[model samples]
Target: GLGDHPTVLYLGKLSRLEGSELLKGIIEEVLESVPNAMFLIVGDGPARESVERFVEQQGLSERVVFTGWVPHSRVADYIIAADICLLPRRHTSFSPYTSPENILKAGEYMALGKPVVAPKMGGFADAEFPVIPAEPEEMAQAVVEFLRNPRQVPEFQRPTWEVSHARLQRVYSAIGAVSR
Candidate 1:
């Protein structure tokens, strides 16, 4: 994950299967092209210790900041503080489907007016957010583009949660009344 500046931030637990290495590779490439960027990782899990060790071994300790386990209520603070929200969900043979809930929430971040840069896999590909291919290199490039010019991202149009609930009320009324 990158930092407050133009950097690649990974906001998830560190795990080999979660594609941390792939993200790291992408960040390295991005740094090569744009030397000012950095990486930021939020959250902690079973893989945290190993990932921190790897960061130290690879001399990326300065580039990465591990926030450990953040509470759900406080999670949004991290998201809101970030220039971009990242969700690099990796799929396996056993993993049958990708849910868009994360993408939707990321969209919420965009609705709050923050540009998102995530892989176009699972539900991410279908989200309203401007998602690109799942390649690490491309992901880095995408981040670069977004940070450079966030206005190009898809505009946020979804109503707030309250508005959505009100719309649902209308749906219920129509369903119960039957189409005239």
Candidate 2:
């Protein structure tokens, strides 16, 4: 779960699906729309080096923070520390199966009462948060709105992991019954 921040943020690797190139443009647009905006990027991947080069090339070296790949245990702390949480994976059918844990993490963020912004797609359809399509302009605008008025996003509801385990138990039982 990414934490909500007063600053505009883009976390995660620049995978082809995540649209890393659009982030720089979106950040530029967001800054233009909202003053006092900042951008933080976490994680490293095949595109990390390229993204760093691009950030330098675009002269955004000062405006963006790159943390490289932090350990998984430390990810939650970073999310909790931010003002807004961002999960900008591209929308795809495979998203549900591949990224359901992310939606769950978004719920964790919500439980902590942080506003989350994610692309509306598989795995997240059932999860909570302000889901939106994967578009930089729209994302930029959403970041501006969230920053301008953080309270606008409703309170988050963090369910206990035990409850989730129970729900999964029922689901698995139902599946087993059907198979039987």
Candidate 3:
């Protein structure tokens, strides 16, 4: 069962854009701090096979579990199973305007009161989401801190994922990105 280990979950695309390639270093660092840490990596993309090969090479087969891909309806189960959630992707230059609001899984994780460690780029920059926005290299420390002292995340209301009509008018009038 997952009860015996500190489970860290990464639920999203496994592409380089998503920082999936950096998972190897993050995993190795996390294990150094918390030897019994278990990683539950979900989703699949171009980098999945390469990431899997690294895991096997390091003989972390028992410590890490990859679920390939699961249906959207089942994401909550994985989020609930984790001790901590991670937004492994650090840079989002390709999509500079990507909004964190589009990350449906983030709302799910925070709604379940999971402490998410996301990078301060893309949509996550300056956003008021209830997550820990730490650099990707510093992620291991953030994960270890939470595992050592679990805390209830502040109440997070799931956003309606809608653009308010009033807000749109404000942006049009200002001719700039809106902030509120």
Candidate 4:
């Protein structure tokens, strides 16, 4: 049961590259303001142990729920269960120059009309939707504020597979024309 407590959902791999350390810090900060808030991490990877250790060290085992890894089919259920979605990726060597080519996760959250708090890095910086800073203090503040006063879900225009395929075809045709 989701109950009445606000839930913060992070649906991605638990790896160093995914910024697990930064996530721990953000959770700590969020607990300061909203101790009852629950964190739902729904993925697993090499960094899972480290994140789990941090939770144990901080005595946050009760607040943080590690779902390990769920199947793609069940992902929507978790997303729907969350009040806020978090994407706390830290800046890495290639982050400044590169953005995530795959916006599927973010898009899914937006499609569900959920508020997503992500770091302003890489592709996230260019995201059409609003994103919060990567800093723990700032991210935590954003989460706390949202829990206190829920905001209106933005109108999202998620592209379907057919729409994306058509767009790609157009781009390829344009490139072919230019090459000729």
Candidate 5:
């Protein structure tokens, strides 16, 4: 049982680009403000072992819950259980132009009425939702602030797949018109 502990969730692959290192730092900072905070990492990848080691090294084993690999069907359960969703991708050379495929994950979290704390990079920078910085201190502050007033988090109206498909069609139509 999660009990009354405030849970911060990350529901994507545990890779280096996912900012596992920064997450550790943010966890330490968040603990200062939220002593009983729990981080629910709900995916597994090549970087899982290293992240686990880092958690242990930082003496954060008890606070961070690593769920390894969960079935896709069960992802929503974890999201529903979270108080906040985290997207801590660190900015890099590829971040400026490359949009992560996982941008949809932010929409999912928002659809569930969960506030997301993501770095302002790549797709996040262009996102309609609110975003914090990728810096550890800023992430920690955002998390603490959200916890203090969860209701203040902005409302996000997630577009349906059909709406997205129609928008793509419109874009293609305009591109064809220009290329003629």
Candidate 6:
């Protein structure tokens, strides 16, 4: 993906449909451009074996670490260890439903003041984070740019549990008013 960067992370389920296939190309392109770069492929799925094989085939085993899956509480540790947070998901038919506000990782990565490189689809074009096409070339360019000139996160707004609960209460009240 053209986003989210150094000590780069391609976080999500390790499935081809999730854009794991894109990583092989992106990784090759990125390594050629930024030889010192390392990648972290976090999460587990059916495609894990093949993805690892491809990385090894490219002789990138030393540079890419596959954590399989980590506990949710530990996710932040990985994000903190990285220079950027790249989501490996391609824009899908359901993409219109995805946005930094709804995607927990986008918020997590941003909360840590890291650039989030996500696809240009969905509502991300106007997003405060780096929005670009996930094609390998485009993504690599955005990623390299961030690594060369790390973008600073200005503000990340994710409703806390208390805030979400209050919103739900308001929603329920509205429903009850309509019934009455």
Per-residue lDDT for 10-90 in model 4, tens only? 888887677687788878888778867889999999999999999999999998899998899999999889988887766
Where is model 1 more than 4 Å wrong at Cα?
1-4, 99-108, 130-133, 152-159, 162-180
lDDT of 2 by residue, 1-180 (tens): 123325544556666566676665676766667655566777877777877887787776776678988887777666656677676655455544437556665666666556767665565545444543344346667766777766634532345577667677888888895342
Best by the lDDT measure: 3
The better candidate by TM-score, 1 or 5, is 5
Q: Provide the lDDT at 98 for model 2.
A: 33
lDDT of 1 by residue, 39-119 (tens): 667777667787678667777677667888777787667666666666665566744344455556566665655656655
lDDT, residue 112, model 5? 72
Per-candidate local distance difference test: 0.62, 0.62, 0.77, 0.76, 0.75, 0.70
TM-scores for all candidates: the values are 0.70, 0.69, 0.78, 0.78, 0.77, 0.74
- By the lDDT metric, which is better: model 2 or model 4? 4
lDDT of 4: 0.76
RMSD, candidate 3, Å: 5.6
Worst 10 residues of 6 by lDDT: 128-137
Ranking according to TM-score, highest score first: 3, 4, 5, 6, 1, 2
Deviating ranges (above 4 Å) for candidate 6: 1-5, 93-102, 130-137, 155-180
* Candidate 4 residue runs with Cα over 4 Å from true position: 97-102, 126-130, 133-137, 155-180
Candidate 4 global Cα RMSD: 4.9
In candidate 4, position 80 carries an lDDT of 88
lDDT of each residue in 1-180, candidate 3, tens digit only:
178898999887787877776788888778778888899998898989988898898888889999988998898899989988888765555655444643666767877767788776666666653677777788778788877777766542433334345556677769756544
**Local accuracy of candidate 5 as per-residue lDDT tens digits, 6-94:** 88888888887777777777777776688888889899988889888888888889988999999989988998889888887766886
TM-score of 5: 0.77
Model 3 reaches what TM-score against the true structure?
Answer: 0.78
